[model samples]
Target: MTRSATLDVLIVGGGIAGLGLAGYLARQGCEPTVVEQATEWRSSGYGIGLWSDGLAVLDELDCLGAVRQRAADPNRIEIRATGGERLRQTTIPPDRTLLLAVHRADLHAALRTAVPADWIRMGTTPARIRERRGGVDVTFDDGRTETFDLVVGADGIHSTVREQCFTEWTLRDLDTYVWSLWVEEDVDVGGDMVSVWGPGSEGFVARVGDRVGVNLAARLESAPEPPALDELRTLADAVDWQRPALLEETDEEPFFDRVREVTCERWRTDRVALVGDAAHALHPIAGMGASLALQDARVLAQELATTRPERVSTALDRFEARRRKPVEREKRKARVEAAVTFVESEPLRRLRNGVVEHTPILDLFVRQQAISG
Candidate 1:
């Protein structure tokens, strides 16, 4: 491909979305600079299930092999009652394409390696995004200012870019709190993902390569807030099978956060645009968050690559139009998944479990998330 003239692009956040976009834009002859507020790039999560759609994006970026080398098979997911009684089992649909479970840090490292290190400016973030006539002038936290042809906000849920550009967008709390941690030592998790359902709470254990990841979710009657790790252990003590041991062995500090979904009136305007979690943060129940974000990076790069600098706004519109419907659908389905996972009443939980086991519902969901994400 012939290189086009440089269209100075500034990408906020050095996460997957930003790095992926930077790699793609650089290939398209854009001098893209990524600014991350952290002293170094980092993410708080254990294993992530990368469906075929997500792998396809990585494949396009030529990083699938690297990620696959460190990934594990997400072959089966089991749902069980708090007492360890098996409720349902869903076999991930067979596909020619790969479905992988990988540590978030491994995936991040893969994407980071794809981009030039000098292109990333760690410990730097825009304190102000001043909109110019046809571009944006960003004032960095270090008191440096620069103008760019386009500014892409791949920042996360509490995005400063979104706050500056799309002030109308709001993060809608799902009244859920989550705690996730990884075991320091390898645990024999049998290469399958398990979710244990309890009253107002749910716990999950997934095999991430040699190690195991434990995550807990609770539905709160009031606003969501992070609970202490000991409180998490107390809650996990009621769960079945190896969950208690898994929780106990997680010696590291757990990742705690409120579950939130972003509602944006528009994903882009003027010279500014939002992608990934900054544009739409879905409930984690769906397991499509990273997949969708990588998809956003690919689509955004595709749009910008084909359009001229003067027509950037049109490209942004096309990007949003193509992504919004599928994402909204995922969000809707995610809500249902959350409701079932966090069901409080025993009778309702039994009913939900029965429906999931006896019906083709799970297979369809699995296919949709794998193929459509």
Candidate 2:
């Protein structure tokens, strides 16, 4: 097999992972094309927490400074019981990097600006894929077929690329749902961030730039979907916290989704590979979703930077190996945090809170998640 001067890469999904990878690959002189199912460029969530590792990747793509300008750095977190009893307040050490909080739309815009407009195809979906030596042939829903040295599935949990290529894999429901909103009024959160944990539910408020981001996660008894905002309020009302102000300010619709996890035996097959939520959708409790996706893009870009099209398969394998351990560890942390925050048993909830209050364990764990990839 001969090496090409530039490899053509097809990226599925226009979310954080895809767009971020497109920018990184373009910087390496690879011809990257992104196909988004949505007709226009948009972001789904309200605000995202960018950890140090995620910010570093954005820095590599030259998009961090702009994003930083539009974001708020939160340095402290206040943990409280559902009844507003203060459990513990952890102030991030001065030497540690503060988590940058920004509206998802702003972050998306920053990434989009870095990627060339021509490379992204809006209102498009990959209908079919045929992998051959040194490349893969992809057919779009619009009836166009193209061959690329590499095909990346950066789509989220229900990814088409993953479904078609790794048919054996599936998303595991965590039996929880998350609903979040970004309100114009800044809800009076005591610290940089506040997380209230109660029986069966957890609520978080973060001051992101000029807006307040409120998130509510609940463990459902049955598999029925989470209720709408009005019903959600009733459910959340079971716990006591500063929800009235947050709810009053929440004029725009809330973003709702089920909490699911994806574990793949392999992240790649042939010249095709998965990234971001497509590869491993961890619980959002650890706040590593964006960071992990950004890290995935960075690591994949690094591996692909020095490889030829003929050796792309090996490069992808190396990318998977280098990333898999860290991702799995992150997934484990997310699971543990989810269990602690959403504990329904009153006794278990109190025990967890007592541990958090009496020991430095929870803070250390949070710091570990925040700093490491």
Candidate 3:
């Protein structure tokens, strides 16, 4: 088959992982084309807790200030029980200089704005998957074929690239599902994030922007029946700490959902590899997927920039090895919480919630800064 324009690298998916890789590669002077299945990217999802690790990657890529200006709220978080009983409270990391509670759309918009429009090809996906002489050749849905020195699947879970590149393997599913909702803040719920544990489920709620309060619910095992908006309202109403003032102002609620950390057996192959959710889609309950994904993107970039192009496969293996440990540990932590929060034992559930309510470490868990090259 005849090949089209050559690329130093072809990155799939235009989400944070894909854009982050393209941005860093562009800075390194490598030609990269980011292909997204979606015609237009949207940041309408919930807010992500961008920790120092992810921030450091953004810093190196020269977009940290925009992130800070748009996302960082004053560092403070609270842990509580069903009512307003304060379990634990702390000023978020003082040394990190800043922490963020930015909305999903704002961050996406910021990243998209920084990338050259030509480097991003929206509404495109890889087609006619086959390994070739230099690397891989892909014909797109548009009937365009292109070759690259390297192919990175940043497309996310259910990645077609992953299915085509690797032998069949199991993606172990963790018995948890996450539901997130955004509502206008009615009252001040403090500057800190709030995480609450209940029987058979856990909740994380925080005010990120001027009027947005994001709530996340993670339930263990098989997912429950279909839920409606009122369930979250009921759950939010259940929290009386802020009471009338808080409930009065909250309006225009929207809900989004996902499965928890469903682990895959591996992350790379010759001339091809996975990054971000495509490779290591961790539990959002950990609030670390974005940060971790940014770290993975930077790691892939550092390896590519520093290593010879022919060593791409080796670099991918090393990247996977470097990230697998941290990802596993965090996954295990989330699993433990899932077990406690979703257990049939009522007393055990209460105690777990009790500790989160009182535990100062709630705000200290995810570290998001990038490693220097």
Candidate 4:
């Protein structure tokens, strides 16, 4: 049954960012209702890396055990030159388990499984929201209205809330577009995870349970593929698959994703606030998009946990202040990483690889990740 017209929180978006913050808030003595644009909850997207920082959030939510059981460590990462000239291997050591590569759906399922179904109403979306002295009034697509003490915008890169609150800031296009698909193969991929090389192309594949999940994307100027999975699969196949030619002779219905980095100037407006990808979507090449989302949820919840119900926005402001720096730092890292990408020269690649392998730079980079960890 629905509670009173007023609630402590109304979360917009049912993706990981939304559901996670909702779950975390619910555990923090706040009743949160989640509104998802999707008709029903389903995990039908490409895979993502669940790094240690995000896993720390899952650990708090008590949902980590479920995700851990269904995921693989994929601790071994193999990087090979396009001509097979040099190979570099990196491993997550016994003392430090850096991340677990997981499908987006599985991560979503694990997070949702812990939240009460009644708290989340699928197919509910906000048409408009008004903030007054008492609270915020939220209007839904079904012509219904509800008031809440606070609203959390976890809607993603194209957040409608951001449009409403702080639309003045421009989300600059990074001159690069990304796409991915999940493929299955009977044979092992030689390494647990492989980042293959090609001229102006790069891709990675890891064993997601029994099936193999692959994600590939290159710089595209125009509409590279139709905004659908089947069409994007064609684009996925168009890229250079330098990963030992496993999919060259297979017919599979693979999951696909078209990616773009989301940047924004404003994250909080009055009583309603943005978190996770809604606040900022970083470039996917950094492999930290999912990590950032999870971190946003975790930090936002921590800030709210200690504040009174009436002071939620103040907590959100705190969340914005603490998050902006670390997130911007990662964005800068992604820009540098994406600018060079896999297209540069062999000498350049060797120079970059050698720096990562033989110098303290890589260790410092790892320590930066440890900041969030």
Candidate 5:
């Protein structure tokens, strides 16, 4: 492949990671083609808490104002036990700790508005990707073939690009299932993010925009192929606070999935690269997935823009090197959090609760995780 003045980039998956990278690359004068499998924009009907890092990325993309208009500012976080015993409470100052709880659809819409409309190809997917010496030859599901200077697999955990390029990648099941949903009702948590922990299960409730968002997680022996709402309801029964209202709002089909972490030996191969969940799918318990995805977009865009098109491989290597350490650190923290939140042992749970109640560990953890670098 001959060197070009501008890099022609192809991004798979049009979700947060793909769209965010597209937005950054576009701002750098790179016209990136984004292919999304969905025919239309899908609303997740769930909320995500974006820390300062995520907000900074949106601000750089000039989408922060729009996101703020659709987001809620939770002033604090409250952690409690199954019997409604307060374990820890941490205050989140807007100036100090920037945490915005926004609906997933709203955040996606903000990112979508940042990119060129024509750049996104809906209902499209790549059928084959062949990496030649110069560029990657991609065959789309619609039988269209295109060659680009760079191909990015920002397509979440089960990325086709990663599957094709990095065959050694594996997904580690966390032996947990999560259910999340949003309801149009008031949840009086005093404008705070409330988390209720029980044996082998946990629940979260927060006021997002004008709706109440609820997330429930439970530890299981094996992955449930078809998760039943009744089983989720049974887990909800284990908790007292926020049970009745959350159960009342639970739909027949809420967002349900098994929690899995993506582990890969490498994030790049020649000109093909992986970003976001495609490279490292951290457990949602860390609340860093979206933020890290945004960070990946920014770093990868910077590296590619600064490097010559002929040195695209070097840029990708730098992108991976810059992201690997922090991502791995967060993954470890998420695993620890999962253990504490879903511990089944009575004595261990008591010890964890006692430590949280007495020390500033929760506050320090939140603050530490909120920092981007």
Candidate 6:
């Protein structure tokens, strides 16, 4: 993959990781084709918090200004009880790291626009992937077979590329369901990111400019199919503040899904590799998914751009070796946080609250999360 050689690269999944990688590679003089299953760009989902590391990647792509224009800067993060009593609060020091709360759609749009339009092929996916001597052969859903010097899977947790090329992978169900939506109605959040936790449930509310974004998560014995509006209302009954307005403004189709994590012992083969959620999907409670994806894009693009075609496998190895530690650490942190925040036992919940109220546990957690790795 020398700068002069035209290394044909195919990136699966056109989400944040894929697009970010494509943009970086293009800047390095490599043209990568991205294939997404969606027919058109999806402007869905609630908001995401981007720390300095993610912002740095956007700046490298020359899209930081575009993202900041549509994003909201939050100076504080607050944790509250069900009755709106603030248990802990931490201020985001601008001198340290920056935090921006932007809708998921806006972030996706910014990354998508940074990549060339023709580099993406929508409405189709790779049907089969076969690794050869120095390259990989990919068969698309449209019955076309093509060979590329390298194939990277940024597809996501349920990645087809991972399933086809690798065997030691599992999608661990977290036994939790989440509902998220963004509404234009005003809610009193004081322009801060606020999270409320109740027994077996947690809700996050953040003001993105004039609109507000809400995310609700609850632990369950089993994951169910998409629930009806009435069922969602019942779930919202756990939280008091802004529930009425959030329910009333809920769209006909809101984001609802089971939370799962992807764990893979190996993220690459001879000519194929995985990045972002495809390799290691963490619990959403960690709020590090998008940031990790951006970081993975930067590292993988760097490895591939500088290596030669004959040693593409070594490049893939270097990419995984550099990224696996931070990703695994965050995965463990997310699981621990989820366990503490979503405790169903009344006694344990009270003990957890007491510890959080008296100690600086929440503040420490925020600081740990602020580190971009």
TM-score of each: 0.94, 0.95, 0.85, 0.87, 0.95, 0.96
Q: Which is superior by lDDT, 1 or 4?
A: 1
Residue pairs of candidate 1 with colliding backbone atoms: none
Clashing residue pairs in candidate 5 (N, C-alpha, C atoms within 3 angstroms): none
lDDT for every model? 0.81, 0.84, 0.68, 0.71, 0.85, 0.84
lDDT of 6 by residue, 55-94 (tens): 8999999878888888877778888877777888888776
RMSD of every prediction = 2.0, 2.2, 4.3, 3.6, 2.3, 1.7
For 227-339, candidate 5 gives per-residue lDDT tens digits of 56777777888877776667786464678888889999999988999999999998888888888899999999888876666789999999999999989988898888887
lDDT of 4 by residue, 1-373 (tens): 2222124788899888887887777776667888888897765676787767888888888888888776767656776545433356666575666777788888899888767888887787888988886788999999999998888888887787777766655555654544455556676666787766544556777887777777665555555454444434444454434333545534554454455667677688668888887777877777788778878888887787767656766777899999999899888888886766656466776676665556555445455665664
Task: Output the lDDT of residue 143, model 2.
Answer: 94
User: By lDDT, who's the top model here?
Assistant: 5
Decide which is better by TM-score, 1 or 5.
5
lDDT tens digits by residue: candidate 2, 1-373: 2123377889999899999999888877776889999997665575677888998989888898889888867678889998789899888776666588787888999999889999888999999999987578888898999998899999999999999889767689877888888777846778888889867888888887787888888887665543466657865677668776678766677888788999888899879999999999988888889999999999989888878778888889899999999998888888887877888888888899999899987578666866685
Ranking by TM-score: 6, 5, 2, 1, 4, 3
Q: Point out the higher-scoring one by TM-score: 4 or 6.
A: 6
- What's the number of clashes in each of the models? 0, 0, 14, 2, 0, 2
- Candidate 1's C-alpha runs over 4 A off are 1-4, 92-98, 184-186, 221-227
Runs in model 5 with CA error above 4 Å? 1-5, 225-227, 250-252
| Candidate 3 least-lDDT 10 residues | 364-373
Tell me the TM-score of model 4.
0.87
Error of 1 at 51 (Å): 1.3
- Scored by lDDT, model 1 comes in at 0.81
